[model samples]
Every structure is written in structure tokens, then in C-alpha cells.
Target chain A: MLQTDQLKFAYTGGDTFSFPDISCERGAHWLLLGQSGSGKTTFLHLLGGLLSPKSGAIRLEGTDMAQLSGPALDRFRGRHIGIIFQKAHFVNALTVGENLALAQELAGVPVDNGRIAKLLDRLNVGQKIHRKPDRLSVGEQQRVAIARALVNSPELILADEPTSALDDENCEQVLHLLTEQAASVKATLLIVTHDGRLKDKIPNQIRLDS
Target chain B: MNILQLSWKNLINKPLSMLLSTILFALGVGLVSLIMLLNKQLDQQFARNLEGIDMVIGAKGSPLQLVLSSIYHLDAPTGNINIGEAKAFLRPEHPLINRAIPLSLGDSYRGYRIVGTNHNIIDHYGAEISEGKIWEAPLEVTIGSRVAEREGLKIGDTFYSTHGLDINEDLEHDDAGAFRVVGILQPGGTVIDQLILTAAESIWEVHDHAPAPVGAAPAEEEHDHEAGEEHAEGEEHTEATHAAPATDIPLHERVDKDITAILVNFKARNAMTLNLPRTINENTNLMAANPSYEISKLFDQLGLGEQVLRWLAYIIIGVSFLSIFISLFNSLKDRKYELAIMRTLGASPGKLFLLIIFEGLLLAVLGYILGILLSHVGIEMIGQFVKKADRYGFTGKTFLPGEGWLFLGALFVGLLAAVIPAWQARQTDIHDTLAEG
Candidate 1:
């Protein structure tokens, strides 16, 4: 479960944003939509604990994110939250399996190859475990990124415009995979995007103003 | 996976740049190590050859030339000294002198110097006869072990002596006589290993028929038949006393004898140790040159060239460090986004910093190994050249005394070169970097 109350943030020498408070239950999926300059990505970053909210109390499972700082904040985020970037970027030098293992290591969890293999098999990318990310097709790469997000079985999943660059068919497939993977892990999912194509798929939505 | 594995993968991602940096580093280390090996071995060789001789007394010329010729036998003699004048220190009653060995150098057998001296010279070098007896008769020679092996000479093999130090067959003294090999000295790892030893009278006998040079009077002493009897009665009769065949004639009267030099070893801490050199230099026609002083001067003359080469090697090392720094810095800029992605995956700033540092350490260790191998190969090539030039083989396979310091120096360079890049990596703005894409 995730909760926020009166979250407001501002960049240096930039305009401030006052966000609407929201509450989401466990195993629920929601979309955060906004136009360009609407600070949609900034809001996602703030929720992911990558940026501090100027005035906020973000609660994830009854723990306040504002109280955590430095390494404590990083460790808590790693163990409890998973993030998917707009572009599916990977460390080009490591194999898919190694990347998955790295996610677990950074989360301070013992590496479980069995969990990684099972996640990849469920995502229909089990054959790409030993291949470098650069050698895989775009669809495979996206699936591997999704598998990485679920490797640690975090409580919340945050995706930032993950399907904006794909075709309509790939966009639908990626959205389905993201929601399915989040459901399988019993995690609350939030996707922030400017694309209106995702409006009909996810009924629960929060729209930000520029 | 681990930081080391990640660093390794990152390094290999840009194979060309990493390879270039490693090669530059290897060249720098290899040159410095080669110089250290050569300088150490040459210093050891010089010190080893100048072991026993305290002072060299030779004709009035350059003291360095005298030391080089008499002690190392690597240069031409200054000139000849009167045998009668140099004989006073050879007397057993002399107070300051412990031992004095006379050397008459004029001829060579196949580029190896034929040093005409008494048995005392062999004793001073601790050379034992390995095959045959010592030379007792004129024109009978004892070759050194290396000389015997190199020249393929054995006992009773006859060889003609050349007139000068070089191996010129045109200057061969065939008319004088063919010198027979009577003995072979054992290998002493000194200058003695390159010489052919014979009695002092053989030098005088070899040039007995040649006309003496003008303006120099060959000192001819009349034989006091009683002194000859006394010499035979008193102590061991030296080979100088038996130069003449007829008993009625004096030994020096037969030929005006001249010696090239006299190597003297004084009694330890004797009062005359200080006074003898001054007395010999200022009073006598011969000059006394200290082997240690002359060798130090030789090093001083060679120091400038060595210093310049050392600086060049250091500059190469500096350039190598610069290349490593530049390569790492450039790659850091290119991998900024990837690093930001890692941060999102829960990698801390300190871990990213260590990953960059690990890359540097890996490059340095690989370069060090390659550099040491290159230096050893260089040493082997130089050793072969030196062995061909002189029979004295250069021992370059041994590790140098300062190599441990070199290892530390390489590591320090790697650490220093990586500091800025690793700092940049640690300071990466993950939010801004990820937002760009």
C-alpha cells in the first residue's frame, strides 16, 4: 500500500508544484498522466525516493520516506520499491542473468538464480538469460527489464513512460506484462506517462496540471 | 555481480583504449627496469675485477688509463717503466708493501693479452692450475680457463704472440718464437680469466732482437756474481734472477728490461699507505694510481648520460599515467547514463566510485606483468651482446634490488590517475541523467 498527503516539490530556480494527495491499496494498478512541463516524471522520481519532496509525507506500508536519508534511504528504496525507466537501459556488458542477479545484490538480498529463471520464464524471455542485453531485440530487452523489476519482489513498482516509444501493439503488450508482473508479486503499480492511449486500459488515474 | 567483475566488463567494453594505455605503461616500466639491470651488473663487474689491487704503478700518463690497463686489462698501457726502478718495492724488506707483482705487457695471442708476470700474480688471484703445471721456461705460457676454452687451447699447444695488444696476424712475432701452452689456470671470475700468463723473462726474450726505441736508455746492470750466489742461497730464487743462461754474466745485462706496470698491495693501515702514492707520484718516474679513485672518476664521467636516460624513462612513465587518466575520464563521460541506471538499481555512490578505481588497478597490474616480461627479454638480448664483446658474461637474470619500489610506484600512478574519474562517477546526478532519456 502507498499513501501521500499534500506533496509539493520544486527544482532550483524553477516553478513549484503542489500535487493532489492519493492513496492506493496493495495489488492495485494506477496511471499518473500529465502533459509536457507538467512534472509527471518529477512526481514519479519523488515517489521513488530519488528526489526529496519540498513538503510531503509519502507513506509506503506505514513508513515515512521523508525521515530516510543517504544510505538508509537508498537501502529502504532498494528493498521495498522497483522502478522501470522510459527507455529500457541495461548495462550493455553484463548478461541478462547477471543483470538480474545484480538487482538482487544491490537490494541486499541473497541472489536466487531459481527466482530469476522463473521470472524470466514467466515473462517468456527464459532463452535470453545468457545473452547480453545489446544482442536481444527491443521486445526481449523490455521483458528483461520487467523481469529485473520483479527479481526482488518489491512491494511497489513505478514505471516512467515505459511504453511511450513503442508501437500501439508493443505498447499494449508492455502494459499488459507490467500489470501482470506487478499482480503476480502482489505489488501496487503506478505508471506515469503523457500518452493518452493508456487512459482506457487503467481505470484508476490521477492527472497532474502544468 | 561484483564490483570487480563489473569493472572488468567495463574495461573490455573499450578494448582499443585499454590496450593502448597498457602498452604505453608497459614500455615505460620496461625501459626503467632494463636500465636498473644494466647499471647494477656493470657496477658489480667493475667492483669484482678491482678486488685485490690497491694501487697501480705505471708509466707517467693518464692515471685512468693506467688503472684500466693494469687492473682491468681493458685498455692500452700508458708506456713502459724501467724494470730496475720498479724493483725496489718488490724487495721483501720494503716496509709499506705487502706484495708487488710486475707486469710486462706487449704481446697478445688472438686478442687475449699475454701478461708476463711471476707466479705471485697467479697466487694473488687464487688461480690454481686446472690442467698443466706453471710456466718455468721461456716461451712457455699458461692460459686462463676462459682463454683455454674460448681459444680451444690445451697443454703443449703452441701459439705465436702478436706484437701489440690487438689480434693482428701481421704483427705476430713468428721470428721471435712460438709460445707453448704449459698450463691452464682455473676460472676465477676476475681479470685473470682473460689473460695468458708467462714468466717475465719471456716478454723480454720475445722482444730481445727488436731495436729499442730512441731517447730511452735501457738500464743494463752488471752481474755481481756474488749477488747471484746470495740470491740462490738466501730465499726462493725468483724468475727475474734466472733470466740469463751464463753464470758469469749479469741477469739485467743480457737485455735492457722494461716493465709495463707494477700492481702493489700495501700492508693494512700502514703509515706508508698515504706517503707511498705521493712519494711515487712526485719522486719516482712511475705513477701510483688508486684503483678505487680512478673507478669513481669513471663513474662520474658516465653519470651524466645515465641521468639523461633515467629522466627519459621517467617521462615515459608520466606519459603513460596521462594516457590512463585521459582514457578513464573520457569513458566516464560516455558511461554517465549507464552509471545513473546503476544508481536506480540500488548501487550506492561509494560503490560506483570503487568500481572506477578497480578498473584502474586492474589495468596497472596487467601492465606491470607485461612490462617485467619485456624487461627480462631485453636483458637477455643485452647479455648476449656483452658476452660476445668480452668473455665476461653479464648476469641480468637476477632481480634488481629496487624492483619492489617500482611495483609501488606503478600502483601509485594508477591510483593517482583514477582519482578524478572516480570522483566524477561518485558525484553523478542520477535524477538528471535518467531524466535526459
Candidate 2:
């Protein structure tokens, strides 16, 4: 469900910051590891359709990511791709459930309270639904972001250095939850990070040149 | 859950700043709306009485004052033109000089000042008498609805005049003539209702002779009870020298002189091509003023106050916009990861752009609603103050909604101010924010 061919990438205004060819199939779990400034986040941004390729094409479920525009890209991203930022940012003014509800509304989806409740319960962030991210613990915020990402059951999941601040045990738990969510959706999961400790947890891995 | 709640919540997060901005927006539009409303009401008030006998040739102090006092009854008139000189000026080719109504002021009956206009003021100017006929002379009178209600006068009732611009109780110093309330005029929503209507002859006749007996009042030849009775009671009826009607003349003709002003009308208003300039400089003693031009010039002279208020209002609005901008701009530093998280959630940059702009548009609309409400309430408060000052003989209540354009304009300005920041959000780099996070 994911395809790339001769996918060389470069920053639009610069000669450096290029990415080598890489491709992954549906349900594949992979970790992209690199040192700081090695462009792991940039490559993940490209995979997530958050950045347009300078010279490569990204296809997901036979649809070219470059072909979508405006609301189409938004809709495609809403139902088929989910991302967990390193810090689990949220609309701080809103409660957890409302944040989830907004993702659905901005994506033009129906509000499904039952599903949201079940997702919150599974992520262990159920009681925090009525609270804003600013008031929640860091772990709770991470779980809330996970619930938001899985709320729409997207086809692909991407995370950008989401476990850097956690202890080894908590990092393992978050990684397990991320993998479990990807499994439930039958999605391909790609995680970008500079840490090497998580290398053994995933079967497939790509290392970027420093 | 939708954009609206998010917007409201965002604004509520910083109450002090939100309030400051709202006040700024309110001030910008509020002042402009106030001036426009007052100007419109005053203009309508001025235009209403600008009817009939086409020229006003008074002693030229300020024609506006002459017009205001004589026609609109707002101030003391520039002193009266000599009755003889006014009539002589009408001898020119102006056909519409068809009639004259010399107004005589300077006395008050209860807070309503008594004006001496031609008795023909009723028919000629369409002052419909709801009760009785027009007064025939100075001592005979008519009251407008407002005057009648305030003083409680009716036909056959009489009242004595006090000596100034407003109500006073020097009844012993009152004029010897007790004005008969011959008529009570209807409500015309014009300056007429605030006035005590009387013939111009009555004004001149009432003040023309001092210590004059009431029986010898002008135009009383047909109705003076004392003259008729004394004529019958004595064989030497001519002995009461002052007990005769001064003239059996019509009200305007009885004046036998120039009017307070000449109200000129063209055979057609388009006749101004030949008349405007000639009319402006035609007489050495009189100056023809274009009402609109003069008012505009007056606005130019007083432009400082208007500009200060206008800019103050705009600056307040500008500050409001900046407040909104600052709120969002500061919030941007806090929301980097969240925005990046939205990006990973497949949320397009365009949706994020809408979020900021939506907040601004909502703030502006709320501020607009509050501002309009404040303006109406403010004007009503002013009206009350004016009405209570009615003791000074001013009609003090006027505020209207035709001035909505000012508020609408402020709202549009706010919408435009939000565009830049919104565009910046749309173009933000998800990688930078996410990487930083």
C-alpha cells in the first residue's frame, strides 16, 4: 500500500538535505534512525505528506500523494494517514474529547463518542478526555495524541521522535501501543528517531548517513 | 468541538486582552456613528422648515444663524431686517417672492418662545390646524402639540408672556395682552411642534407699541370686544383714541415692510445655473449660501474634532486587530508541536490557516454587536439629557439607524486585518515545528 521509486529528495532552495530511495509495503513496521541533522524528521515529513518532494513521488494505496490538492489532500491525510509528533502537541484551549472531535470535524467526519471513549480507554487516557493537554501529564498527553491519531482508523501511521523524553520502560510501552494501533488498522508504521535503543523492537530498519 | 467554540475558548483564555481589543473596536466605529446620526437628524430638522417665501434678508451676521433662528427656531435670529427695507428688496424680478412672513421673536410664553410669523404661515406652509383657525392678530395665537401639552392651553384660554428665551414667573411684568389660544396645531414631526405658532403681524403688532391698550391691538377691528362695546356705550365714540383697530389689513400686509429673510425658489431648481452666483452676491446686505456647501465648509472648519474622533476610533480598531494578532502570534510559539501533530494527523496546512482567521472573524463580529448596542444606548442617554434641558427650549431627542454603515465598515476592516496572519499559518513548515519539538 506504500510505494516509492528512485525517490531521491532535496530541499527546494538548497543542494543538500537529500533523501535516498526507500519503499515499504502495507503493515510494515520500520524505524528510521539517524544522528541529529541527518534529516530523519524531513524524511518522515515526506512520508506523512507534510512536505512536498522536490523530485520524488510517494504513492499510498495506489494514489499519488503529489496529485491531491487542498481539501483532497486534507481528506486523504485525515482518513489514511496519522502522525504522532515528538512532543504530542494539542489545541491547548480544548478538552481531550473536543480535540478528537475537531480532528473529525476538520476532516469532515461524524462524531463517534463511543469509539472515542473506547480508544481513550485502550490508550489509558479515558478519564482525561474532559481535560486539556496543558493539565495532563506528559504520558497522558502522549496517549491522548495516540487516541486522536487512531480515532479515524487511518491506513498509515508515522511518528517523529515521540519517545525521546521517556525512560526506556515508558518508551517500550509507547512503542508497543503505537505498534498495536498500527496492527489494529492493518496500517504500515514508520517511526523516525535519532535514538538507537529502539532498533531491536522493530524488525525492519533504515539508517541515514550522518 | 467546532471552530466557533475553539474561537470563543481562545478569546476567553486571555480576557484582559480580549476586552481591550473589543473596546478599541467599539470606540473606532462608535464615534463615527454618533456624528453621522446627529448630522442626519439635524439636517432633517433644518430641511423640514426650509419651506415657503423664498428669501431671508436679515441683518447679515451669519446666514446660518438667521436661518436657524428664523426658519428652524434653534437660536436667537440675527437681528430683524427693517420691515420696509425687506419689502423693497423683493421688488426685483423674483416672482416667488410671492409672499412674506416676518418673524418677531425675543419673548417667551412658558418655555416655548412666541414667534410672530404671518398668519398665512398655516395655509402657506401647510401647518394643519387640528382644532381651530389661525390667529388673526398679535394677541390672538396658535399652539403646536408640544407647546399645548407643556403649557396646557386650548382655544379661548389665554396666557401672558414672560420676558426671555425660557420660562419665567415675572407675571407682573408680563405683556398687557393675553394671547387667545385660537388654534392648536397637529403633529408634523417638524420644528413646528416645538414652536408657538403665531402671525408675523402678531409678532410685530404685539411688540410694536408699548403701553398700548389691548383694545387697540392691530387687526382687532372685527373682533375687539372692548372697541365694539365702547363704540356702543358712548355718543362720542372717537374719545377713546387708542381703542380702534390699527388697520383692517391682512397679517403680512399689515407689517408694511421687509421680512426677516427672503426664501428664494427657482422657477426650477435647475435655474441655479443663472441664479446661484447672482443670488450669492446679488445684494450687498445679503449673501446667498448653498446650504450643502456651507454645511460642508462648516464641517471642514470643524474637521479637527471629527478627524480626532475618527482616528481615535480607527486606532482603537487597529489596536484591537493588533491584540488579536498578538494573541495568535504568541500562541504560535506554544502550538508548534500541536501544529506538527496536526500535520502528522494528515491535517492540511490550509485547515490550520482557517483556524486562526476564524478566531479573528468571530472576535470582530462579537465586538461589532456590542459596539452597536452601546451606540444605541449612548444616543438614548444623550436624548434624555437634551429632553430634560427642554427648559432651554431645545428639542433634544434624535438618534437613528441609517448610521449602520459606520459599524459595518468597522467590521469589514477587522476581517481584512486577519488575512495576513492567517496566510502565514498556512505557509508554516511542519518539519521546523516538529523537529524543534
Candidate 3:
């Protein structure tokens, strides 16, 4: 389970955002809907422990993320949360399987190549595990990125505009794959996006105002 | 993957930049190491042989040339000195001198010099006979260990002498009877190791019958001219001369005798003996040069060139550090997003910092290993070309103790070159970088 109450954040001498409170049970799917400049990405970063909030409590599985800092917070995030960015960026020097292995290594967990292969096969990217992220097609790279995120079997999956760069057909397929993979891992999935095509893809939604 | 593996992968990803930095660093290290090796070996050879002997009495010429020729056998002797004049220091009753070993030069057997000296010269260098007996008769030769090994001359083997030190010149003394190898010395690691030893009478006998108007002129014609002058002096002094067997006459009585140099050791380091070189240089025709003084002066001159080369090597290392810095800095700029992604994957800022440092360290370590190998190979080639392999007797196989310090210095250079770039990598703004991407 993941929950946030009145999460607030501000960039240095820039816009401040006060996010709406949201709570989700384990393995639940939620769409965090927002227009451009609504600070949806900021809220997602604060929830993922990538950014510290000005004032709020982001509790993930009963632990407040705001209380942890430095390596401890980074480790906790690695063990319990998974994040996917919009553009499906990766360490271009590593192959797909190596990227997944790096994620497990950084999390201080013993890497399981079998789990990695199974996850990629579930995402229909089993054949691309040996390929570099750059050499893969955009859809294939996105699927590989999904495998990297779920490789650690975290408790929460945070996707920030992951489908914004995809076409309509890819957007639908990726949404279906994200929910299926999240359910298999029994993880709470929250997708933050400004793409309107994903409006009806998930019934549960939370909207951010300008 | 571990941070070290990540660093390695990143370096291999951009092979050109890594190779350029590594090669630049290696060249600088190689040059500096070569100079260090050469300087250390030269000092060892000079110091080892220059021990015990105090002054070299020879013909008036460059003092350094006299030391090099008489002590190191690395150059031609400066003409020759008359044995009558040099015999003053050779007397056992002399107050200032303890031992004086006279050397007669101007002949070689296949490029190795045949030094005509007494048995005291063998004891002077701490040489032991490995085979056969010492040369007691004229024309009987005792070859040094190196000469014996290289010429393959054993006891009872006979070889003819050439006119001068050079082997390229075919000024063979066919008229002179072949000198028999009577003894072989154990390796003493001195100039004596490359010489063929005999009594002073053998050199006189060899040149006494040498036919005039030789085939090829020796490089220093003054040697032959001085020998002729001594022969002329001998004819005026005695009737029992060149036709008489060389073994029949004593060395001191033969006024026709001319020695190349005399290696003198002082009885005590008193003011009189300390001033002996100056007194002999000013009071006599024979020039006296202190071996240590001349060797230090030689080093002072060589030190200047070594200092310049060391500075050049340092400058090259500095440029290589800069190259490494630029390469890492540029790569950091390009990999900002990926570094942020690593952060998201639970790589701490400190981890990123170590990653960059490891990358720099890997390159430096590679350069250092290659550099040391390059320097030894370079020195080996130079040793072969300069004929120092057997003569001065140093090889590239030697590893100096100072190289351990050099290794630490290279690692420091790597750490220094990576500081700023690693700092920037540590300060990577994860949220902003991810948002931008």
C-alpha cells in the first residue's frame, strides 16, 4: 500500500505545488491526471523519494519516505519503489539484461537472470535482452525499461508520462502491459501523465490543477 | 554490475579518448623511466669501478676522456705516457702512493683491449682466476671473464693483436707472434672484465715487431707516434733492445717502454696526497686526473640534460592529465542523464563519484604498466645500439627501487585528474535531470 497526504514542493525561486492527498491499497492502479505545468511530475518525484517535499508525509507500506535521506533513502527507494521516465532512457553502455542486473546490484539484492528473462518474456521483449537500449525500437526500449523497473519487485511503481511519447496504438498496448505487469508483481501502480489518450485506460484517477 | 565494472564499461565505450590519454601518459612515463634507469646504471658502473683508485696518470688531453678510457674503457686513451716518468708513482717507497698499476694500451684482439699490466692490477680489481694461471711471461695473456665469454677463448688458445682499439679497422699485426691465453678471470664487474691482461713486456713485444706503414691508420695516431718516440729513446739508451727477447729485460730497465696510464691509490688522504694530482699535473709532462672529480664533473654535465628531459617528461604528464580531465569532463556532460538514471536505480552520489575515480585509475594503471615496459624495451634497444650491453655492462632488466614511488605518483595523478569531474558527477541533480530527459 502507498499513501500521500497534502504533499507540497517548490523549486528554488520557482513555482510551488501543493498536491492532493491520495491513498492506494496494494496492487491497485491509479492515474494521476494533469495538464502541462500542473506539477504532476514533481508530485511523482516527491512520492518516489527522488525529490524532498517542502511539507508532507509520503508513506509507502507504513514508512514515511520524507524521514529518510541520503543513502538510506536511496536504498529504501531502490528496494521498495520502481520508476519509469517518459523517454525510456537507460545506461546506453549496458545491454538490456545488464541494465536489469545493475538495478538489482544497486539495490543490494542478488540478481536473478531467470526473473529478468521471465519479465522480459511477459512483456514480449525476451529476444531484445542482449540488445542495447539505443538499438531497440522505441516500443521495444519502453518494454525493456518496464522490465528494468520490475526487476527488483518493488512495492510501488511510479511512471511519469511513460506513454506520452508513444503513438496511440503503442499507448494502448503499453498501458495494458503496465497494468498486467503491476498486477503480477502485486505492486501499487501510479502513472502521472498529461496525455489525454490515457484518460479512460484506467478508471481510478487523481487530477492536479494549474 | 559493480562500480569498477561500470567504470570499465564506460571507458571501453569510448575507446578513442581512453587510448589517447593512456598513450600520452605512457610516453611521458616511459621517457622519465628511461632517463632514471640510464642515470642509475651509469652511476653504479662508475661508482663501482672508481672505488679504491684515486688518480689516473695519462697523456695530456681531456681529463674526462682519460678517466673514461683508463677506468671505464669507454673511450680511446689520451695518447700514451712514458713509463719512466710514470714510474715515480709506481715506486713502493713513495710516501703518498700506496699502489700504482701501470697500463699499456694500443692493441686489441677482436675488439677487446689487451691491457698490459702487472699482477697487482689483478689484485687491485679483486679478480680471481677462474681457470689456468696468471701471465708470468711476455706474450702470455690472461683474459677477463667477459672477453673470455664473448671471444670463446680458453686456456692455451692463441690470437693475434690488432693495431688499435677499433675492431672495424683491419690493422692486424701478422708479423707479431700470437699471444697465448694463459688464464681467465672470474667476473669482477669492472672495466677489467672486458680486457685481456698481460705483462707490460707483451705490449712492447707486440709493437716492437709491428711492421711500419700499416694497412689502416688507427684513429688516434698519437698512440703509435708515442710508441715510436719511446723506441727511438730506447735505441739511444741501450744496445740490448728490440732484438733481445722481451722477457729477458726488466720492465723498468727498458727505456723503450711507454705505458698508456697509471691507476694510483693513495696511502693516506693527507694534504700532500690530496695535492698530489695538482703537483703532478703542474710539475710533470704526464697529466694526473682524479677519477672521482672527473666523474662528478661528467655527471654535472649529464645532469643538465637529464634535468631538461625530466622536466619535459613532467610537462608531458601534465598535458596527459589535462587530456584525461577533458575527456572525463566531456563524458560527464554527455552522461548526465544516465548518471541521474543510476541515481534512480539506487546509486548514491558517492557511488557515482567513485565510478569516475575508478575510470581514471584504470587508465593510469594501464599507462603505468605499459610505460615501464616501454622504458625497459627502449633502454634494451639503446644498450644494444650503444654497445653498452657488454662493455659498460648494464641491461634493461634492472628495476630501480624508486619505481615504487613512481607508481604512487601515477596513482596520485589519476586521482588528481578525476577530482573535479567526479565532483560534478556527485552533484548530479537527479530530479531535474530525469524531468529534462
Best by DockQ, which number? 3
- The candidates' interface RMSDs, in order, read 1.1, 2.2, 0.8
lDDT of candidate 3 at residue B293, scale 0 to 100: 95
lDDT of 3: 0.85
Candidate 2: tens digits of C-alpha lDDT, residues B35-144? 66555655565555665434455666776676556666667655555545455434434554445455666566766867776554565567788898776644677888
Estimate every model's Cα lDDT from 0 to 1.
0.82, 0.67, 0.85
Which pairs clash inside model 1?
none
Model 2 ranges with Cα > 4 A deviation: A1-6, A12-34, A53-59, A62-74, A193-209, B1-9, B58-64, B78-96, B152-157, B171-175, B199-247, B251-331, B390-412
Tell me each candidate's RMSD, in Å, in order: 5.5, 6.3, 3.7
Q: For model 3, what TM-score does chain A reach?
A: 0.97
- Give per-residue CA lDDT, model 3, range B1-437, as digits (tens): 89999999999989999999999999888888988999999899889999999999999989999999888887888887776777677676778888888888778888898888888798889999999999877778899998888878989988788887777445877665578888999988888888999988777766765665354333224334344443443342122233334454545555546788989988888888888889988999989898999999989999999999999999999999999999999999889988998999898999999999998888888889899999999888877875544567557898988888888889999999998999999999998888877
TM accuracy, model 1: 0.88
Q: TM-score each candidate.
A: 0.88, 0.79, 0.94
Clash list (residue pairs), candidate 3: none
Comparison by lDDT, 2 against 3, better one: 3
Tens digit per residue, CA lDDT, model 1, B1-437: 78998999988888999999899889888888878887888788899888778888998989999999888888888888776777776665677778788888867888899988777788788889899998877667898888888889998888778777766777676655578888998888887888999877677665653333232222211212332332233332233344443323322343346778888888775666967787989998889999999999999888888888889988988998999999999998778877887887788889899999988888887787788889888888777886666655676578876877888888888888898999999998878988888
Error of 3 at B415 (Å): 0.5
Candidate with maximal TM-score? 3
The per-candidate count of clashes, in order, stands at: 0, 24, 0
- Writing each residue's lDDT as its tens digit, candidate 3 over A89-112 gives 888888899999999999999989
Docking level for model 1: medium
